[model samples]
Target chain A: MSFLLWLESTGFGTFVRESESLFAYPTFIVLHTFGLSIVVGISVVVGTRLMGLAPTIPLAPLNKLFPIMWFGFAINLFSGSGLAAAAASTTIPNPLFIAKIIFVLTAVAVMVVLQVKVFRDPEVDDKPLDTMSKALGGSLLALWLLAMISGRLITYIA
Target chain B: MNYSHIHIVLNHFPTIGTFFGLALFLYALWKKKQDMQIASFVTFMVMAVLVIPTFITGAAAEGAVSQRPGVNPALVALHQDAAIVAFTLLVLTGTFAWLALWQYRRFNAPSQWTVWTVMGLAIITMAMMMQTATLGGEISHPEIRAEGVAEVTAPPEGEEGIAYALQMWMVNNAWVWPTGETLHFTGMTLLFGVMFLVNFRLLGMLRGVPFSAIHRFLPLGILGFGVTMTSGVLMFNADFHRYVAVPTFFLKMFLVVVAGISVLYVTIFDDTWALGKGDGTALRHKIFAVTNTLLWLGAMYFGRMIPYLE
Candidate 1:
């Protein structure tokens, strides 16, 4: 925690903290949000599809969107971390803060699994997702929403 | 004077009112065994109806606030003007909600055309909401504050750096404010669309559907969160403390983090909730899902109130 605080107070942290330039800190934050939309948006769509909303839509092609989903996650990785660093650089331990970090780690892990199990075989064609697939989708959906709600809580709780 | 009063009433009323209405709707969705669906639908209708009074009273409040001392004439004007647009959007959103409910009853299950219409209206309503929210932010924060196209030009020299920085950022960023504002609005729709479905799923209103399939909508929710975070950061970069330090903003962030983590946990640890098993199988899953939705909603509502609280 002390090291985290020290890191936040460094010159880089100061830059994020004090920079008047719109591109510096604000850009990262904006990027972070965009990433959130892509990643979470994809999750919701795929998860719901797997659950059986748009049964007519093929599952395999929809899976193709996985790369973009991961890409969004990547954006969040870079931007969210930067914001966290900038934030932790100055302040003391924010417990709710720790919770957000933990959530991100979990979200990433689930996404990685999704990529491997679901989208790995590009040769696959459109078919209704199997029960296992639905389960995965349900779990994925639940994780994303939990992450989102918790993320929102950071604004108020801590 | 009238503008100020209108601003106060219009601003706070819709916000709190929306929360209540949404709460009722969610409650209805939850108790699916009962006539919760009908109750939820009714709650939404009432919410739509409330929009009218909220809009009118808001106008009166805005009239009262416009005359306050040290107020920027330009900002006051922008706030008033934007209110008309936002109010209009809210009315439209309410109407759409009513229509969507009507269609749901008529066709049973959301019809393709009805879904499209609701989606379109949601998008437009979101845009209007963003403009209204931006205007509301400007009423007090004034830092990097922009309403519509005109930049809130900086005050005379010797003005505080915070104010100057805000003005400079607002002026320098080309279309960032408007685009960011639009994205913010879109985020709300995404949040609502995905979340409501998730909520409905839990309550058994959407039982035939597998919870996993519902998971696909997670991306849309993410999209909304992304929009919010992006727009929020743009505003934050312009002025961080104004909102970040506020309790409302703080609480909102906390809820978001909770939602995010919970989603991740459920996804990876298949052990957490049995997938594809149908509803009522996993109490834990239901609790978490329901809790997550509520938190996200809370964050959004609180965020909408930042300006009013000040």
Candidate 2:
């Protein structure tokens, strides 16, 4: 708790919370949003393919998307940390903020399972995906969307 | 009642109608009833088409409620932005459903693949509808607001950036706002139509139509993108502060970057080039096509969301 308050009182935090300039805190928020869209958007598209929505589109090349997905994560990690730092005292205690974290973690776990267990499976190209992989793809989307919604709701309730 | 009131009254129909339509579609999917699916597609299609007015009236709603006491301009902006995004997805889902119906009517029945495609789109659209509804609920209902969420403070009265001549002129002129908005929608429609053709082709729909044939129409969509990009900037310059303060606008700009990158990618790396009937496209290229389509739609979603989420 002390740490959060200390961080919030820092010069950076004050700048974010109190800045009138468009380029300051708001730009960070925007970057986070884009990072999120890329991460979540690619996940949805890849997941959709896994579920056999686009059967003719072969699975071999999907390996290329992992890097793009990671790039989005990097953006989010940087911007999210900055955003969180700016409002630590208030944001840390916020239920929605907590919920967003939980959702994001679960999404990450699901994403890992998707990347390691499903995408890396040797039979991915030859056989239909197991029912579990399909279900995980759907869950990944749901969790990330929940996180985004909760994060957005923070502004509404606060 | 004015536009807002009419919107409030009519809004329930689309939201409720979606559930009713989805229920029917689900029933059809379960029973494998082609005819039933066709009927439900039409139902979904009608529901999607009806949302257009609600979306247009939304600006009017903003106009009406913006000045009312206890109304937060930021909340209204967020709700409006969220609504536009949901509406865009709804439009895409509806158009896809219409195609499904056409497939059935012309061919005597759609393939299993077509049914699956429709189901996938419906699931996505339903999710968007729920998101949109939730954001809309937050506007007047503070009780529903997430705990500890701060109300967005209004920025200063005036916001002016570098101010290009035409952009400044449009922003200053009241008449230009609506004109820009109308053009924005027209551009959106043109882009969506082209996307439908291009994306569906990538997904193996319109198989008889060659990739090169569809390639010919890329410029039309690019033109639409260009139009919207210009209009969007004008709109932004018009009310710089509201948009800048709104987080969603920044997100929209990011999506535009994604869309722009995808356009560059497609021009250079679209693996479908030189492909024809009986010629297969590379998997990587198809993935790029799909990604680009979603990126643009995502951009559109964020663009509309700017006002409400901002």
Candidate 3:
């Protein structure tokens, strides 16, 4: 608890919490918002495609989106850390915040599984999606939605 | 011109343009002219882009007139309510029209469902546009209110019927604002993702895939924009005073216009449309792609800075 309190009192944390400069908390929040959009947005498109929407879109080429998603993930990781550090004492103990982290992490794990098992398949584009792939896509979508919901609710609930 | 003047000037385009586009579309259907059909589709798409500014200016116009002695806040509210519904339908019609055009480019003809969908949406949207226009006129032009306008009771001095209720609900409910924020961010993600895919393609990132295949997903981006704009208006309505005072809000709005117009170039221009697998983009198209990406980034940046800047 003291460590968390110390983290919250650090210069970066203080800047995030109390700085009037745009580069401080505002910039972190902006990055977080942008990152969320990219990661969740691409996930939705890919998820729907797996469930058979926009079938004409060739699957292999969609590997391009993963790199972009990773870039977004990087931004989120950095910005989310800044935000968490700012409110470490309060947010670290909040169950809602923890749920958000779990949802996001699980969603990321699902994305990796899809990338390896589904997207890496040589026949991904040539054949219809199998039941397992479709189920994975559905869960990926569900998990992301949960992540978004919990993330948004963190402000209100805590 | 002031926002009121701009609103008045721009408002006619969506209403009258829809009528003209619908008429031309019907004639094109009868004549079986693909060029004419494409022309109407382009008109619908341009109007969609223009409506963003028109709606924004309408809010500014309301601010200008709402405090006047005889302005009637209730009438303003009624107009706003009608405008929201009309704006939604118009955006949907425009999206369908874009889908039709994309289908035409890809399949040599738009699918039957897409064609019928645009027609149905256009017809209904035209009617709503007219209704919105009538309500808008009644807000200031008492001469046009007519005897039948009495059906809309003047709520108390500051209260607007549905609009007032919605504003209060948004303010009072803790969940509503955060929900709006979530959806707004979701919409932003959708718009950004689509923009990233399309713009990156133009910048030569996805070289092997044909632009047409990626073009198929443009509607999703437009849908995202539609969502963002709708939720944005709701949030703005809930807190217009604070929003209007922020300089960054104006900068963000300006960037939106530039970015909105720039995206249309990618949508309708033959230069980018003709790009197939392994085809490099022309220098000019690449420049426009970079400008569009930066404009979008600027819009998001300024939007996030709205509260902090002021």
Candidate 4:
């Protein structure tokens, strides 16, 4: 606790406490919140798609929306690190902090697998759900949702 | 009695309203019921209804906050100004959405005009949501004041100096901020749209599309994630301390990570999705998709709460 207090009061901490820059602080906060929207928003579509909600649409075309999801990921990565720098000492120890890192690592891994196995397969049609594909989709959906719920809990748990 | 309180609540109303609508949409999807779909659409449209009142109330609140103690004038002003832009975008997007829905309901099949109109509205609404959220951020963080100046003096030596210098550099470089915000919005739309699609598929709504096909969208999802991450870092680099300290911030980040990991696991090890084979993976997709939806909803809940809490 003493260390936490000391860290918060240090010169670096003071700058965070006292500095005024529309771009530096506010921009990050905005981006962070905005990132959440993207992250969750895309998860809704992808997750729902896996569950068989919109049958009329093609999965490949729907994949067109992936760029946006990646965009959110990119935003959070930088924004998240910047935020971490502010209070590395405290944040490093925080349970939420550890969870976030682990989650990101796993999410990216899942994404990579998705790319290699599903998207790359030329034979697979943008047609309908089979047993295995549905299972995969369901799992992907769960990963994203868990990510979101855990994200929200960060606010309360800490 | 406090105008600020009123305005904050008013401005925030649409955001909450939109979520409620989305929730309804999710519920509809879950039940595989058309009524729920209609109800959800109606809920979403309510965003239009609340937009004007939110703006008016927000304006009033801004005026009051400027005069109050402990509130930074610059921050209040920034919030007020950005809010106006958000309000304008919301109103425009809401109108388009309403018209699209109207056209959708009245006609046997949606026309090109209506389709384009609805698409356009969705795009615009997403953009506005990004701007509105950004402005909301300014309300709390005076350090990020748009004036491109900082109150924190530079620290001496080592990590502190580097951090301070970086923060100052971010302030001095003005061009990046606007562009960053724009990119953030683009990423936001992509992410939201794709996520919606994923959720829709999981609930057994889109039976025709192969479950494997959903994986194709992952690339686009990644792209959106990229944009969001880039902009996010710029902000974080500038103000590491406050954001790190904020409780909700940590939570949101954590949830995002979890969502990402779940995506990976589903894509890799799961052997359940065999398109139209012996059986369909609908049940599995449903369960995971539902869980994903809940996680995101939780993130949204906490994200919204960040501002109101101390």
Ten-residue stretch with the least lDDT total in model 4 chain B: B269-278
TM-score of each: 0.43, 0.46, 0.87, 0.40
Question: lDDT per residue, candidate 1, A73-156, as tens digits?
Answer: 889887776777787733326666666667667767776776777756564334445678778778876776556655554555
Judging by lDDT against the true structure, name the best candidate: 3
Evaluated at residue B107, the lDDT of candidate 3 is 74
Error of 4 at B282 (Å): 37
Model 1: residue B268 alpha-carbon error in angstroms = 39
Worst 10 residues of 1 chain A by lDDT: A121-130
What docking class should model 1 receive? Answer: incorrect
Off by over 4 Å in 2: B1-310
Each prediction's DockQ against the real complex: 0.06, 0.02, 0.51, 0.15
Better of 1 and 4 by DockQ: 4
lDDT score of residue A74 within candidate 4: 88
lDDT of 3 by residue, A109-149 (tens): 98899898888777877877899888888898788878888
Interface RMSD of each: 10.0, 9.4, 1.6, 10.1
The per-residue C-alpha lDDT of model 4 at residue B122 equals 47
Q: For model 3, name the residue pairs that clash.
A: none
Instruction: Give all candidates' CA lDDT scores.
Output: 0.57, 0.66, 0.83, 0.56
**How would you encode candidate 2's per-residue C-alpha lDDT over B58-92 as one tens digit per residue?**
55567667787767777676566566666766666
- Mind giving the per-residue lDDT tens digits that candidate 1 earns over B73-170? 55655554555555555544454454445444334444556444544544555565557666666676656554443456434665534334554676
